[model samples]
Target: MDSMASAPGKAILFGEHAVVYDKPAIALAINKRATITIKESHKDYTSIKSDNIGLEAIISPETGLKLKKGEIGILNYILKALEFYHDSKPIKIKLEIEIPIGAGLGSSAAVTVATIAALDKYHKRKTTLPSIAKRAHKVELEVQGAASPLDTSISTHGGLIYLNEEKKIDQIKGDLKDSLVIGYTQSEDTAKMVKLVKERMERHPTIINHIMDAIAHTTKKAKKALETNDKECLGELMNINQGLLDAIGVNTRSLSDMIYTSREAGALGSKITGAGGGGSIIAYSPNRTRKIIETLKRKGYNAMKADPSKKGVIIEH
Candidate 1:
C-alpha cells in the first residue's frame, strides 16, 4: 500500500518581516502544490528520491543511519520521529515538488509539510494543522534560516489567514474581491536579500523601525478593508507596502517598473511579494487582472493572473 500527501505553496500577501518581530501577517495558499509519497517494501533499507530537485538518500535501521538528509532533508523531523516507532519494515519514499521554485512562493515549505504529512499517515499518526505547522516551521529554518510562520501556517491550514503577533492564527473567510496578477521577474536570491536586510538593520536601526511602523499601520488598514469588503483601501495598502519596501532598498528597478506598468495597465495596486530584490509581484484588480497580464506579456514579462487556492495537497496514484 502507498500513502500520499500534498500541500499548496504560499505567498506573503502582506507583512513579511514584521511578523518575525511580533506583528500581524497575512498569507494565502496558491493553486500550485507539491506531493510526497511513501510505500512499504521488503528492501533491507529505505530509500528517498526526489526527481524534481536532484535529491536522493537511503536510510537503514540496522546501521543506525536514520537521520533524514540529502534528497528530502525536509523530512528530518519525521525521520527523527520514525526512529521512535522502529518500523523495522523497510520502506521506499518518493518526493516531488511541482511548485515553481524561488518564485517568492512558499514552494519549499509546502513540500516539507506534504512530506511530513505523508509520513504521518503512513505511520497512522494523528497530524493536526497545528502539529503540521510546528513541524514545518522547524523545517523552514533549514531552507530559510528564519521564515515567518505565515507561509507554513497558510500552507497547512489551506485558507486565507491572519497571523497575529501572539502566534494565534485567525482564518479570514471573505470574498477576495480582486484577482492578483503574478509577474515573474526571474531573479531569486533569498539568502543574499536576507543578508542585505540584516546588514541594513544593523546599520540603520532607525530606518528599519520607521519602515516597520509604517507597515504595521498600513497592515491594519489593509485588514480592515478586507473585513469591510473595501477593495480600494486594500489596494492602497498594497501600494503603501511597496513604498515601504522601496525605503528598505530591496525593491529592484525591474520589479518597480513591472509594478508601475501593471498599475498603468489597470491594476488597482501592486507590490513585490516575498524578499523582494527580484522575485514576483502581486497586483490586485479583478477587473484589470487580464489586461495587466496581457500588457506584461506584450512587454516580454512572464506574468499570469491567479486566484487564491481552494484546496491543498491533491494526491494522485
Candidate 2:
C-alpha cells in the first residue's frame, strides 16, 4: 500500500522580521504545493528520490547515513518525520514541489508538513492538523536552529492566517487570489540575513525598535483592510510595510529593483515577502498581474501569478 499527501506553500503578506520580535504577521497559503508519496519497499534500505532537486540517496536509520551537502538539511525533516512511526520496514519516498527553493515561499515548511502527514497516514495514526503543525514546527527548529510557527501553521492549516508572537492563530476571511503576483530573485541565506538583523538591532535598539513598531502597526491596519475589502488601502499599507523592511537592511539591489519596477508598472503595492536579501517579492496587482509578470520576465526575473489555497494538507488513498 502507498500513501500520499500534499501541502501548500505560503507568502508572508506583512511583518517578516518584526514578527521575530514578538509582533504579529499575516500569511496566506498559495496554490503551489509540495507533495510526498511513500510506499513500502522490498529493499532493506530506505531510499529517497527527487527529480526536482536531483537527489537520490539510500538512508540508514540505524547507523545514520551521510547526505550530500544540499540534501542534509532537507533530509533531516524526512528523518524526523519517520521517527513518529516505529516500523523499520524500508520505504521509498518521492518529493515534488511547485515552489522554488529558498524563494521565501515556505517550501521547507510545505515539504515537512507533507512528509509528516503522509507518514502519519501510512502508519494509520490519523493525526490532526494542529498536531501535524506542531510536529512540523519541531522539525523546522531542529533543522534551522530557530524558526517561527507561522510557516508550519500556514502550511498545515492553509488559507489566510493571523499569527501573534504568542503562537496564537486567527483565521482571517479574505482571498486576494486574483490580485497576487510573486517575483523571484536569486536565493538568499535566510539564517545569515536573520543574524544580520539581530546584530543591527543590538547596535541601535531605539531606531530598529521604532521601525519594528511601525511594521506591527501596519499588520494591525492590514487586518482591518482585509475585513473592509479595501484593496486600495491594503496596497498602500503593503508599500509602507516594505519601506520598514528596507529600513532594516533586508532589501537587496535585485529585490529593490523588482519592487520598484512592479510599482512603476502600476502595481497597487509591492514588497519583499520573506527574510529578504534577495528572495522574492509579493505585489498586489488587482488588474495588472499580467502586465507585472511580463515586465518582470523581460527584466530576466522569474515571476508567477498566485491564488490563495483554501485547503490544508490532503491525504490521498
Candidate 3:
C-alpha cells in the first residue's frame, strides 16, 4: 500500500523577518503544493528520491543521512521529519514539488508538512493537525537553525493564517478572491537573508526594534483588512511593510524593479513576499491582475496568478 499526501505552500503578506522576533505575521496558503508518496520498501534500508532536485539516496539509522556533492540542503527537512516517526519498516519516499525552491514560498515547509502527513498515514499514526504542525515546525527549526512557526502553521492549516507574537495560529476569515500576482526572480537563500537582518538588528537594536513593531502593527491592520475584504487597505499596508523590509536591507535591485513596475502597471500594492533578497514579490492588483502580470513579463520577469488555497495537508492514499 502507498500513502500519499500533499501540502500547500505559503506567501507571507505583511510580515517576514519581524516574525522571527515573535512579532505578528500574516500568510496565506497558495495553490502550489508539495506532494509526497510513501511505500514500504522491499530493500532493507529506506530510500528517498526527488526529481525536483535530481537526487536519490538511502536513509537509515546505521548510516545516517548523506548528501552527494552539489545537492541542496532542503532535503534536511525530509530527513529531520523521518526522525520523528520511528518506524522500523523501511519505506521508499518520492517527492513531487510544484512550488519553486528557495523562492521564499514556503517550499521547505510544504515538503516537510507533506512528508510528515504521508509518514503518519503510512504508519497509521493518525496525527492531528496541531500535532502535525508542531512536528513540522520542529523539523524546520532543526534544519534552518532559526525559523518562525508562520510557514509550517500555514502549510498545516491552509487558508489565511495569522501568527501572533505568542506563536498562536489563527485562520483569518476572508479570501483573496484571486487578486494576488506573483513575480519571481532567481532563488534567494532564506537563511542568509534572515542572518543579514539579525546582524542589522544587533548593530542598531533600537531602530530595528521599532521597525519590527511597525511591521507587527501593519500585520494587525492587514488582518482586519482581510477580514473586511478591504483590498485597498490591504494594499496600502503591504506597501508599508515593503518599506520596512527594505529598511532591514532585504531588498534587491531586481525585486525593487519588479515591485515598482507592478505598481506602475496599476497594482494596488506590491511588495516582497518573503525574506526578499532575490525570491519573489507579490502584487495585489484585484481586477488589474492580468495587466500587472503582462507588464511584469515585458520586463523579463516570471509572473503568474496564485489563488489562496483553503486546504492544508491531506492524505491522498
The digit string of per-residue lDDT tens for model 2 on 1-317 reads 78999999999999998888889999999999999999898877888888887767777756556554245646667777776543767899998889888898898899999999998888898799999999998887777767788899999999999997687999998759688999997667677787899999999999999999999999999999988889999999999999999899999899999999999998989999988999999999897899999999999999999899988898897
Candidate 1 regions with alpha-carbon error over 4 angstroms: 41-46, 50-90, 312-317
Encode model 1's per-residue lDDT on 9-49: one tens digit a residue.
Answer: 87677887677667788778887778878899778898777
| Quality of model 3 by C-alpha lDDT | 0.88
lDDT per residue as tens, model 3, 1-317:
68999999999988899999999999999999999999888987888888876868786668866554326566778888888764667889899898988888999999999999998888788689999999999998888888998899999999988888899888888768668899998666788888889999999999999999999999999999989999889889999999999899999999999999999999889999988889899999888889988999999999989899999998885
lDDT of each: 0.76, 0.88, 0.88
User: Positional deviation of 250 in candidate 1, in angstroms?
Assistant: 1.7
TM-score of each: 0.85, 0.95, 0.95
Ranking by TM-score: 3, 2, 1
Tell me which residue pairs clash in candidate 2.
Answer: none
Off by over 4 Å in 3: 60-70
Candidate 1: worst-modelled 10 consecutive residues by lDDT: 77-86
